[model samples]
Target: MLPNPTLDQLQVFLAVAESGSFSAASRALNRAQSVISYTIANLEAQLEVPLFERSGSRQPKLTEAGTAMLEDARRIVSDLEVMRARVKGLKEGLEAEVAVAISVMVPTDVMVDVLSEFRERFPSVSMRLNVGELGEMIDLVASGISTIGIGGAIVKQDDSLSIERIGHSFMMPVAAPHHPLARLNRPLTLADVREEVQLVVTDSSGHTKGRDFNVLSYKTWRVSDIATKHHLIRGGLGWGGLPASLIYEDLQTGRLVALELEAYEQGEYPIYAIRKISNPPGPAAAWMLEAFRASLSRCPNLEAFKAQLPFNRSKDAIAAE
Candidate 1:
């Protein structure tokens, strides 16, 4: 096995190489010149290599081996400094890792904004993002699989978690322009909706078992993700509610049409940042929560919803997925 050089010796060697002389290295390290020279000699002896040239009457110069090791020494010292800083931050209530469960309903632009800022603000802290739909977001936090959850929960929220209303997801029933619902082109009654199919987003987590939201139709189809449901709706397969942010362009281009229902119409659902009361958010988590709230409120769809349906104060489709 190769002999190991001590950290002190490597540091001394680095100082000498950087300063170009033993006396300058001693002054920089606040050590005696003899001591600095001795440390370098011991390091070279341990590694079995000549670290400096000792020619008469000139400042000390690094040999090829010394020059090569200089980069390695700098890297080691830099890594040590980073580790020390991270540990210091951790001790000061900064989370070592921030794990968040996100809902698809949260405006995609808001999600992207919060995530990008979080990375830049907390370079030392690790991050985990789990994307889920509806109740799955809340379940991840309740089960301690995530540090916090960002979304709305339909069922009576469990008392064990702390729920903070962050913003709103403007939801409304929509269908393809050519669908039977749009063909009627007037206010729809419950009977008219029940006769058609409704596409519902189903979560495998079953966190909200035995609970159904906004299911007016007797003939319903369950799908796993919002993308598939959106695809089917665009294809005129069925009608269902979607968060306005996701289908803004669709609405503008008439790929889908918002339906006017006399009996039932979906509206704003409160988006929440949920966390277990026992596992409170650390510094990083708190920062993200604030960022999410401020950013979500400015969502173009949420603003559109506010303007388009000023008179519509309908209670949202909580698990409307």
Candidate 2:
């Protein structure tokens, strides 16, 4: 009766078949030629079939059964290699999976750069991104729905959370080309701003309930997310603050014009890297934070924004205040 095949026996069979000779297989496997020949002989005996056709030639030919078995043997070995690598990664405090919550307030360029690098750096770690705004973003980290949160620290932080202000996204008030605010070439007065409709991104989460930031216009159109607010502004629905990275093309193409609001000075909204205090960032998460910080620091076109700003507030000044 045929016996069950062993991994070693199968491996030896594959090596011999692939290398075309028992001596070559031994050289490739760093085993004695006799050991390779014996393993194959035992494997063939266990299977009740000859795997290699031996006509006293230096190179043995694979039988039909041996060739057919190669595919399964190769697959099993490849799967084992992957499992070994994953186990090693786990032992090194590497995260099996990571979910990063990036705030929409973070510059788009920074996100793309950091994420691109992260994929290369942590090839084995599975990644998920939760892009949110204001408190909704923070809530994800606090609730452990996201591994880390990258956005504004709008809500008062709690002991359950750890926050670090990494960098800032330059907030510019923008209006579509044909909007009333866009037509006003000079700095707009408080009355002018209050009179026009302002599109405000509201925090849907209860963390910052009823709180308003820079909502100047009494006639405000509230939206629950930044993308919606951006879409509204683009359709000439209302004017609002958008990250410079988002409007870079719009401004360049004259599709959207940065408004010169006397009542509202263009400033940097503090971007933070936050995570749960209990579940501090793991190796992959930690590297991602640094990657984000470095990328955000080099966010494109501070000079371009400076040249284009009707009035500028330095990031340091914004920090101090």
Candidate 3:
């Protein structure tokens, strides 16, 4: 294996790559032109490859191998930056910035509001957003790639992390305007749905949570994208359990209606704001968590049930249900 190149060599490489002239790179980096040339020379020696092709008059240009090495050098610099950020974060008392991941099931608008509030309060803080499956969010938190995560209730038996029930999000079985359920006056019985087609969002391995819709004969139309599922339901394709936040406007506009069920509560999952217990989050992350709670409280449509609950509910209460 090749020895790891020093950061100084990578910086010189980047400066020359960007400026296309050793003299120009020296000027930009405030170093001597000979030093810049020697740094690149040393890097080439270490890597045992010619990084640049010299010409009589034209500026030095990258060879094919140099182009690939340039990409690797950029990644090395990025990794250094992350290390610097982590150390700087520890020294500066949470001003150095951190990434937080949240699932897409949460409303984008609400996240925007929470992030905007966080930015205004801590102007120097930085953030990166990762939107993925619930499992991915949990992994980000557990692995320390992210300081915090917002996701749905993880039903598996792992106990590596802690969860806070910041809010309650229920899934409403919704269908388009002309769907048969929209015309029903009374609550639809579980038996009424047995024969109906269903749309579901499954995991990477094609698994979905919640109880089986036995009345519908356990049929399903699998779709990956949440937006696609919403649109498919709107197009009168099939019924599915969608987050209440995503369907707020549609429910009000009469474009979609929640199906009544004998056991309406089966599809509900507690919206969790999680962090690894071993890694107490930095102040900026904590602020975002608070802002998330505030946003949930301010949503009038959901406030009735969510406003009264503390971010961390008793485990007994969670398990009692």
Candidate 4:
């Protein structure tokens, strides 16, 4: 009967396979070269196969059998790591999974960067992410569907939810170059905007069902997401406000022209990180909150907006007032 190989043996085999030499594996694993050779030999004896082609002058190379088994060994080692992490997380009282909802208005590049760091920082903590428009993000947190939410400033204050102002993004009104509003020779007035079709994003959560923000036009086209609004505006369908970060290229390339409207020239939108007051964030979620704040604070456009603002407010003060 074949003997059962131990994890230690498999680990040594993988180290030698990767390092290409038992001596190199010894340095990596902090063990004597003889110990690494002995472990590999035992692993080979138990498996009844020679894993490495032994040569006196050249580096050890994986045999056909070694190549075939390498992937399985890697998978086993990976699964063991995940198991160890989960066990450690349990010991530390960390939640097994954390759900976070992010607003679509948040720059996708920034979101990707922060979440990538988050994965490395908390490998054991599984994440559930939801991207929504307007108030849908906050609704997810308030309704217990998500542990936390990163989104625009909350309009309706509730004692059940805690809000932290992370940063601000600038929203600029824009239209396609061919759109009628863009052709006007002079600065646009409220009457000019009121005559044109305004592309607006509707709240998916129904919390702000009948509310209209910065709506000056009587004729409107409503969409549930920002991408759709951007597409429609680029097609010369209508005009509306979009995050400056999202439309920077469009503005620079003349694909979309900024509207110099009298009533709504440009506006700054506050972004927030929200969580239910009853269910405070776990360690992983708290780490994510800080990651988001740090990422946004470093955004160049947002930094410019910060410089232009009348006064700077700390996150705690913004949350408080």
Q: Pick the candidate with the highest TM-score.
A: 4
| Runs with alpha carbons beyond 4 Å of true place in candidate 4 | 1-6, 23-49, 55-59, 300-321
Off by over 4 Å in 3: 1-91, 107-109, 205-217, 266-268, 297-321
| Model 3 whole-model lDDT (C-alpha atoms) | 0.72
Q: In angstroms, what RMSD does candidate 1 have relative to the true structure?
A: 7.8
lDDT of 4 by residue, 196-259 (tens): 9999998877778888888899999999789999999999999998888788777656677777
The local lDDT score (0 to 100) that residue 316 gets in candidate 1 is 36
Worst 10 residues of 4 by lDDT: 309-318
Please give the RMSD to the true structure for each candidate, in Å. 7.8, 7.8, 12.0, 8.5
| CA lDDT scores, all candidates in order | 0.82, 0.80, 0.72, 0.83
lDDT of 2 by residue, 129-233 (tens): 888877787778877889998885566757777888888876788888677776655578778888789998777786777777677898999888878888899
- Selected candidate, larger lDDT, 1 vs 3: 1
**lDDT assessment of candidate 1:** 0.82
Ten residues in sequence with the least summed lDDT for candidate 1: 312-321
Q: Please list all clashing residue pairs in model 4, or write none if there are none.
A: none
TM-score, every prediction: 0.68, 0.73, 0.59, 0.83
Which residue pairs of candidate 2 clash?
none
Give stretches of model 1 more than 4 Å off: 1-85, 299-303, 306-321
